[model samples]
Target: MDGLLLQGFFRSSAAWRVRIALNLKGIGYAQVARHLRRGEQRAPDFMAKNPQGLVPALEVPGQGVLTQSLAIIEWLEETQPGAPLLPADPWARARVRSLAQIIACDIHPIQNLRVLAYLKRELGQEGPTVDAFARHWITGGLAALEQRLATEAETGLFCHGDAPGLADLCLVPQLGNARRFGTELSPYPTILRIEAACLALPAFQQSAPDRQPDAE
Candidate 1:
């Protein structure tokens, strides 16, 4: 890979984050699809790249493989030059990161496919029960995020400002997962409005799950 090779599955929200960041930064990259449900991530070649066998592993030219979506996003924000994913002001940056973490750390960890599969295959959870499990956490997290975004002065057209940033990248994908689990979204108008604003941009729209070559 002369530039960047993004190793990810089309449906992965984590990978979706990286894709949006990369697009926002205007970086050129190729996709190396690793089908998570098919266990392609566990294949030896990819394992050498990411020991955790997760998607969204970025193969930088000489820097080797970078894992973890948020870490990858922060790395891009720091290194890349196009759009700034985090605000320059320290306090503003912290606020954006805090909002992003609620989705990336709290909501996603609970509702992610890994946990969902374990619930069904390992614990013998029924389909509806597993789905409810996902919706519960996503709903609660969105409620908090909605409250913060709605009331906070920092929030603008996107999560932190007029332009989309790190928090917006995290929000858009999690909302996709929320819809997948059937979470009621009418309550989070701020979040939904931000999502609408994000989708209007080319970077977010092009990085959508269905637009990926490996989709389905």
Candidate 2:
């Protein structure tokens, strides 16, 4: 199979998730950078690929375009099953998905690039104010995550088990965003510990934003 074409920005958390997923699955792909800060995602060419004009759109060789980070990651899990991100058991899979969705669906969308841009441009908010708003939501969500992970029996070296999985993938990128915004993550010891464990893995380390070819 021809390698997939990934159109994404290096610093985008959604894009980062897909990158980590691809690396974990050992899937070879070509990354085409669409710098968000330069408004490249809104260009006519990118819009032709993703009408929504979102970064992290995957152009599968013959299967057409795939949008949304979670969708793309799920596709990778289905198509490339060597390194399974989800658990084998039904209940375990649900638990992992629940934790992942808390970050992906609940926290991420509210603080994504489009949301931040809207806050700044549409609402006339300043950078500091928008950043503070992002940190507020991130901290709140992380607090809840910490509560679950710290108290739950399932929490191990990673978010779910001793091995890194879907929850870890979602957690690491969100933590990266939180740290970028100067959010105080020290409050969540469990999260910090899990993040450290994930970073020890080559897949997560290699897929980090700074390690990307297009990283500034």
Candidate 3:
């Protein structure tokens, strides 16, 4: 087996997504902590591996380095096809990607640490105001998700089907952020159900922020 490494911060939802993918694939890898809070990700050494200065940069023995959580997970799905993260059918795969992007693209990026930091530092937002910002976007995104998941027949125990796939990976992490920022989750019953189902699995549970060694 070749050496594998994951460079990531514990609290980053993006990083958490990749962690879940790796666990689901049953790939063993070493964790190298990059403290996002301390601007460690921007340091020259870490930047060399990931110019984006982002969490969840995966280092593969033969493949060198991989960046971006979604891209990395797609790579894993391609390289290790045994435990597939995507659906077999083309339409189903597209639907799963759509759901995943609703959280990853629409929700997570707006509420990520760097954006929140910008809100406070550059925009001069107070704590409560920033919390409100997070809550508003998260609630809005989840509301849309709730509507789709509630009505769409494709939504099974997980996002797409009974089996947990890419969408479930994206959903769980955003829900974690929703809870942390004091967003009211009672409104989205379907979202809550899916989250409950995902968390019940060890792969999701073990990849949680609090479970990581660098959690603070």
Candidate 4:
């Protein structure tokens, strides 16, 4: 295997997405723990790799550093032929991408650690207020997902089809974040069902936040 290094914080959902994809592809890589809460991602070394100072910066063997979980997963899909993370059909691929973006682009950003920290530190929000903010946005996203997944015939054992793929990568991590923030998941039965199926697989299990080396 060519040298691959993933610099990420354990609890980071973005990092978790990449971890699941790498595991699903059966790729072996070295991990560099970046403690986000301690501002380690902002340090000079990590910043050099990702000027955005974000976790989940992947250093590929010859392609230089790949930032962002979605892009890294797309690179893996294009380069590594093993266990593909995306659907083959064009329309199916678009559907999968749409579901993945719902979390990655819509939900995850507002509930991220930096955003929550800003709410508390910069805006002077109480703990309960920040928690409420997270739950509100996550719940809204889950509500939209629930309506689609429950009614859409395309949704299967996973988000798009029988096999776990890109959508699952995004879904599982956001579910983890929702649970962490005490968001009520009972309303999203389809989501819970899909989450259970994904969790039963070794890739998702091994890539979980609690299973990571730097997990607190």
Candidate 5:
């Protein structure tokens, strides 16, 4: 609970997800900005913390370091337990995980910083081309998510029945990336509606990249 250090980038969606989870649980943390664009994650200090050289590696005072967004979020939920991120029921929890994974597993990994950098540096692709590919994948994934949310009866104010849970946390940041890339979200009315609802809450608002200390 003390000296919680968050090693993260301002615009990194994975980092953003953890920030939202922390805010939702009312956990206080000190943020150490990692500049992803400047290749700071590969520095000796950060690599020592996370050998994979990824942003959003969390350091807790007594528990060592934690990596991966979903794992960190679950760890926070288990340790804190006040504002639970997942549902209490087993089946409902599974559904929430499924929804969250739709974005986290399927969409985010494809458009991650490393992947984009690889496309430009290794594949000899230009910025516009790589950006187009990212947009295509994100748009496709969000389209499916929009359809599911619109038709599912469980979808209410948020992704899962009126509560801002795991799925909404993932969805909001992905939507932010989509908007940054000029991916027209007007097609996904359900997602836009849900995002609007989530943004109305203080937790999501405060966790936004623009509100961060490292934000430009």
Candidate 6:
């Protein structure tokens, strides 16, 4: 097909983030459901598309496959002709990128599937220990983010402003991951408020994990 194709797994926060961006940008794309738990991402055919064997890889019609959720979203922002994912102001754009990186770079890697798999299989960590490990990192990251979103004057209805941007895409999915790991979220009022605002939109509502075709 000539349309965009998204390589993703249901319940993947990174994949979820991309889905939100696509929806927000009003892009039409097909989905290749790679079951991360079943090792579908590591399959040879899938690996050919993404050497890293990760979900949220985007296959452009003319261009080659794009890996990394943020990179894919940025590409969409640049090429697509829909919603604006970044602001006009350079400083605001930098702030949004910074907020997004807190989840993409700092929080996500530690609790990634590969890392958790290593902790469980290689290190022989028990269920509770592995779970605790995820919760610890997620909680700490949210705590820091909550402080910034609360204290910063730039914060409005969303992470950067009234409109959802790159940071909101990251924050919403990370919050979903946080809830999955049973992280108590009441402490982060600002984050929760932003999430509520995001969820109120059709884009966020439609892109949710539970709404995905492969959700289980």
If scored against the real structure, what TM-score would every candidate get? 0.98, 0.96, 0.97, 0.98, 0.97, 0.97
Model 6 per-residue lDDT tens digits across residues 32-62: 8999999999999999998888897988878
Tens-place lDDT digits, model 4, residues 1-216: 568999998999999999999999999988999998899999998899899999899998777899999999998999896788998999989988988888998899999999999999999999999999999889988898888889999999988879999999999999999988999899999999999999999999999988988888
The lDDT values for all models are 0.94, 0.90, 0.90, 0.92, 0.92, 0.91
Clashing pairs in 4: none
- lDDT tens digits by residue: candidate 3, 1-216: 358899998988889999999888888888999998899999999989988898889999876899999999999998784568999899989989998999999999998888889999999999999989998889999999999999999889988889888999999989889989999899999989989998899989999998899998
Model 1 spans with C-alpha error above 4 angstroms = none
- Return the clash pairs for model 6, or none: none
Query: Residue 203 lDDT in model 6?
Result: 98
lDDT, candidate 1, 59-135, per-residue tens = 99978889999999998887888999999999999999999999999999899899999999999999999999999
lDDT of 6 at 104: 94
Which candidate, 2 or 4, has the higher TM-score? 4
Residue-pair clashes per prediction, in order, are 0, 0, 0, 0, 0, 0
User: Against the true structure, whose lDDT is highest?
Assistant: 1
Candidate 3 local accuracy as lDDT?
A: 0.90
TM-score of predicted model 1? 0.98
lDDT of 5 by residue, 122-171 (tens): 99999999989889889989988988899988888998888799999999
Model 3 misplaced regions, further than 4 Å: none
| lDDT, model 1, position 4 | 95
Candidate 2: C-alpha lDDT: 0.90
TM-score of candidate 4 on Cα atoms, chains taken together: 0.98
